[model samples]
Target: MLGDELIALLGDRIPDDHARQWLADRWVPRFYATRPGGARVVDLGCGIGESLDLFRAHDPAVRWVGVDLEDSPEVRERTRGDAEFLTFDGAAIPLPDASVDLVYSKQVFEHVERPRPLLADVARVLRPGGWFCGSLSQMEPYHSLSVGGYTPSGWTTVVEETGLRVVELRPGIDAAALLVRRLLGMPAFADRWFAGTSPLHRALRRHPRLRGGGPRVHNAARLMVSGQFAFLARRPED
Candidate 1:
């Protein structure tokens, strides 16, 4: 999560459609490349529940559950007719073991005070061959009550040390284009990252070498400038 003032300024710039687009464009193609179907997906730290709309309109096969520490009025209102929303005890999840196929979160890891237990739970709930896919801070100013920062290797190491295996790890952005957007004060441009609405980002998706992955994504030498760490890792099968 970013600072409050920054969120207040840029949140809406993150278009409502961007969430669904990011799902269909980025995460699903890679994480589900091996097991494609309506996965039992859980959104960890599901706040206002707006992410409930991230799935495709026609994909009713995908079951969604959101769990958070607070079941606020906003969260309740947004999830009124959609996914099941649960309130958690902050560390342990309530779901049955091996119950879900995918666990997703966005910028939620930093707020977690004890990541080991959380990751342990993630590993526990995920069905074998299931994935934990999402992004975390690599270069943001500490917000969301974060503990600290992590370089790309340090960040990935945290998850691997938890027992899950990293299958795909990448730098999250194309630096030159991002700089151009920031220089132009089109900070709203920041909202579309990894969602691939920008020309530069979209072009990356079409690359012959990068096909099947998401748009505006960079996992190569250019990753050093990215502000976040994005990855897909699976719970191994015996």
Candidate 2:
């Protein structure tokens, strides 16, 4: 009948609106808990070192490195102390082979013109069993220097080509709600739209037919119409 009614039919297949499924604050804490105090982390396309700060907040001993295309004024003005910043030619990362334990990027892939070489470098810089994790746009509006976004399959293909196996993919906020926020000029209050508990999700949760499936089906159901997606890829152990 209605959109929500239709989705409700896919009971147990609906994605959860929790922090773990959404990869928010829950992720950094769990990641650092397992990592060594001096674990090496690289933030690809880091903008003003926000993720680095998050990592350091969890484990101050984390060796943080921020990488971007150029040393922009904003980065120079804001990013300082503790973390190291580096620039690359967009394809090859400047770090040494297998140097990092974690490679983190956030909302930055949508702007990249070429991702294969960059992903190859991601694999190169990561130590064996290291992780490449981040979020990417799927159906969000065009913003700063936006090129194009990737679908779930498209992203998996490229990551797999680099010989890194994808272990996780979670849908972010639904596309319809994200469009609404953009249409409203993305007010500060509208930032809650990123919290994963969109109207669609709440409706699904309310549906009498909706049951808890598993992360696989739950994620697929949401990714079908999500604005963005988060992923975790791992380099195999030697």
Candidate 3:
């Protein structure tokens, strides 16, 4: 099987954080490198707009448009003046054809009930040669509130069918690291361990070998087990 095929077969079982960071590390650089000067970009299914904030921090000049089904109060508060957010109807997106230079999405496709039409919409809004860089889970637990659909050939086939060409495709995060972080409650430790030099950070860092071991292990184990997928594709310049 191909790399993406392997990931599609096994991504969900891997750790979530491992998957998240893997995507962040890979796509952040690509976005920074390819982001056109002062161009408009769209972020679909931008949960809480944290990624939008990251994109803005990377390049403040770019205009960002964010969309999601529901907006939490915290998300609303943080997203204020940062980007434009729209509550979308399930079928149609409120955007013009060939208007955006890039459309970034993460973990959004799997939940879409009508994936084809949604992707067609994505293609409709993207300008020629524009790109769509994002990640989606393959093997994962089902949260009724946040449903995901994993199909190895689905994304590529869909994009090609929509008349877009696959530019670059890379393996995303694995599942093991995700599980460990969740079990360890690392999100709660974000401010404590990751942000500053706290005791927990020192403890984890001192063990040098232990510091970044989870993601590495997760990446390896995911290739062995099943549940991870990520890719970047683009529309032809035509």
| Candidate 1 lDDT for residue 220 | 37
Model 3 misplaced regions, further than 4 Å: 1-21, 70-79, 176-226
Least lDDT summed over 10 consecutive residues: which range in candidate 2?
A: 1-10
Candidate 3, residue 115: CA error in Å? 1.4
TM match of model 1 to true structure:
0.69
lDDT of each: 0.62, 0.75, 0.60
In candidate 2, which residue pairs get closer than 3 Å at backbone N, Cα or C atoms, i.e. clash? Answer: 12-211, 12-213
Q: Which candidate leads the pack in TM-score? A: 2
The sequence of per-residue lDDT tens digits that candidate 3 reaches over residues 38-136 is 767888777677676677667778778887666544345653665687778645678999998888888777666777787888888999888887777
What are the per-model C-alpha RMSD values against the true structure? 9.9, 4.4, 7.4
Q: TM-score for all predictions?
A: 0.69, 0.85, 0.68
Best by lDDT: 2
Q: Taking the tens digit of each residue's C-alpha lDDT, what string does model 1 give over 162-223?
A: 67886655455544554566566657746666555444444644656645433122333223
Q: Which regions in candidate 1 have their CA more than 4 angstroms from the true location?
A: 1-25, 56-58, 71-79, 174-186, 192-220
Q: Number of backbone collisions per candidate, in order?
A: 1, 2, 19
